[model samples]
Target: MLPFYSLLLIATWLVPKYCLVQLNEPFLYISATTFKFVLTSTLFLTKLKMKMSKFVCFITKKLQNLSIFVNPFWIQICYFISVSSVGFLVLKVLKPRNKSFRPNDFDVFFMSVSATTVSSMSTLEMEVFSDTQLTVLTILMVLGGEVFVSVLGLHWLNSKFKKQETQNKVIDPLVVSVEDLRYKSSIRYLSYVVWAYFLVIHIVGSTMISIYMSLVSSARNVLKNKGLHLVTFSMFTTVSTFTNCGFIPTNENMIVFSKHSGLLLILIPQILLGNTLYPPCLRFLIWVLWRLTKREELNYLLRMNFSDGIGYNHLLPFLHSCLLVVTVFGFIVIQFILFCCMEWNSEALKGLNCYQKLVAALFQSVNSRHTGESVVDLSIISPAILVLYVVMMYLPPYTTFLPRKNDEQSLRSNEKMKKRREKLVENLLFSQLSYLAIFIILICITEREKLREDPLNFTVLNIVIEVISAYGNVGFTTGYSCERQLKHDGYCKDAWYGFSGRWSNEGKLILILVMFFGRLKKFNMEGGKGWKLM
Candidate 1:
């Protein structure tokens, strides 16, 4: 502990000098003040070291006791809430690009929640947001991304394991299990792999995007006309795509650059790596590590059975990993064929050559799964294609094809009796679909007036799509059109916002809850499984 304080004192002294060189004068002044305070406190504490150590130990024990009653699930919920709240305040204080376009408090708060949850459901147009606000949204997306959150969880679990191991060594010097050691090491290694994956993808994606924008005249001109910098657009697009948040700096999302097939192709891998294809990519990385390192922990990660292995869910068995890749691309292929066939000559895909159309179709197919960047206006697309998109959005990111094996059946049979006993006390509550149904009903109730007044634009299918998109955390929407209104009133005006933008405040709040539910959906993967339809 004395050594810890010594290191802290050294850091306090060095950090202010570093900040003075790198940061602005204000930050340097703040750091200097902090350094002085810490220095004074350290000198005083050294004089009263014996008494201060006892006080620190007492506080640490009290904190440990308090942490025992804190649930991890609640901690996650609190994290989102706190981030969203801070984002909301920041957005509220920051000025938008448009001087007259001040977003309402609720809309700002809604955007914060959407960004924090990576929902990307927006009520305001993207162009109104300043570059600073866009940067904030990018930060929220990165912090709220699945990979980032999982890595944080892994780090926390690793620390907990180390703490427990230290206690075990104190209790009995030779009592540590080899399996526990391997599991802990595997977690730490996995954390490193994920961190590398996150950084490498962002760096590569941003670099490629920047180069493409610089080399391509059309894309560069589009950013220029919108008053966006090359680096800002590249970084924002990469972060948004890799997080699968679907937030584009432009109002049209990916539509304006649809003809830039090369740009579309570049973003496709980023979309996949961040969401649906994450599991297969992760398993492949682990497999490669095992092949190269021949380490026991890598082998444990690669060979462990999903059901009884290390608690990490992304590390799938080899067979399942292969199946996941097949299933993911199989669905994409189906959607691609259907999209090209049906939309080749449609107005939705007008003005594109055969090559561009093909690339755009494939891009849209990949995005429909979870990444919701769209090249075509989905409203103009064939209803059949939209229905297929809905189905794709409803499926979870890791949905895969797995054939039941005889060995797995035998293993399940061994647990059948225990499952049956557990089922006796299991509560039959709302399933995932049940919850979605409730959200849909609530939104319908809240938007009933508009549903009747603008049935054409506010169709039940559009409502379902919006709700499902929010629940899936995919930002796809059919979009609202003033011309499509049943009766064109004088107040009708077209805006580049999602379908949910037309909904009342209550409906937006309901969608907010849906986004929260969707973000934390892994906890409910087994929901409604306790009920037997037969």
Candidate 2:
């Protein structure tokens, strides 16, 4: 009965999205599923909570034993929205008037995996390739970003609401310090600003790519012919990749002279976003506003930390973000220098004047660290570069995942993050190279096809992609080949992604083994009471 109740509730939210897609745009229903889930879930959750205290109490208590289940409820809800939408979308494509199904599991899994990792692979690339693919990727990447930010926002909302509930009276402020995402008060206004910032960056990045296209296209002056899809593609690609959606639209086809700034723009933002720099920026803006308005209370509010008496942590989070960007940047730079000096064929680079070589350097600089979208041929790169790639791919950039002890007990998880960066970078300097050497040899020798396949098997290549995408959750497939050719019974993804980019089956098994190790990783030294004597 309990299982049945849960299933029914889930189905109620998703049934409309499935039917809606089947009714209209039936061909692209899976593509519509994620958003539709968001829409329907919002509606269902609203109605479920409306004057339904009994149902609420039933759910709240029944799930109390499973705190972890409830903890990630939002993630589950978001994922449910994402997966149901994809199912509807696939059905629309197969268009089963009677019910013969083509179970394209990889396509939908890739969609969910890509969204979770903020990657850019699409069934379209494996099917009828079009620029609209970028738009789909863009939406997924934004949802990924939204999930991260919303979780951060919820941390605030839960605390505030808990306090109010205890007092048994609402102390409402005209400008709320925090609210649910839908509530949109002045405090939540900052979230809107964050959204706008990302949108503008997406547009600017796309526009730059478009300009590059305009310069290189033979039909340069013809605005009517260039098409909005390209602009849309470029913008979405920029934000998608920046937000860590590793999908692409304009592949090897590029406007040689338009400007390579789009590539640079896309690359920089990954570092920026990966570092999660928005909170500090928001804090800065609040400080400026307080000073400008001459509001002492505003200044006091700014000074407050999540827990009492813990003062402002100005440099810790910034430094954490800096180390993350720097480590990735530095590692990728070494990879380029080594690859070019040791592996790159002399003939290709030899003919270049300093300027052309310089541009190629710029290209190399942007793509290697953040994404696997090498403008040049990946198959041709030196074995060492490929080996370097495997090493870089394993870095999971999360503030919460690493060691936590000795860390400051601040709500800003970034402090512990900074400490972990120091440890990983330091370990890499000493022991990681040998360990990486052994791992690389295993990959190259054991995974023969990853190295030797011409147009790599979509299934096999997905393993390579999954390994890389897991760390940063960026999904990009180099233009090695279209996925349809690599499909084995339409389930190449089963073959392609080896355990869902290290977030899946074998990866979890490996983690379970590692958990037995006596000590878990710890963070920055607390000095008895970090930033406090409390």
Off by over 4 Å in 1: 1-67, 406-426
Measured on C-alpha atoms, candidate 1 has an lDDT of 0.82
Model 2, 20-76: lDDT tens digits are 555665334433433333333334334433423343233334333344364434444
lDDT of 1 by residue, 1-534 (tens): 677767777777666666666665655645464444445344533544445335434443443444579755666787788789999999999999997889999999999999988888999999989999998888788778888777666766666677788898899977887877888898888887887787778767877787677667789899999998765687789888999999999999999999999999999999999988888898888778878988777777877877674657776677777887899999999999999889999998899998999999999999998878999998999989999998998888878766745443235434743776544433454588999999999999999999989899989999999999998999999889988877988888888889988889999999999999988887665566667787
State in Å the error of residue 459, model 1: 0.8
Q: After superposition, how far is residue 160 of candidate 2 from its true place, in Å?
A: 6.0
RMSD of 2: 13.1
Off by over 4 Å in 2: 1-69, 73-109, 121-134, 146-167, 170-193, 215-228, 251-329, 343-370, 398-406, 409-466, 476-534
Candidate whose TM-score is highest: 1
* Local distance difference test, candidate 2: 0.42
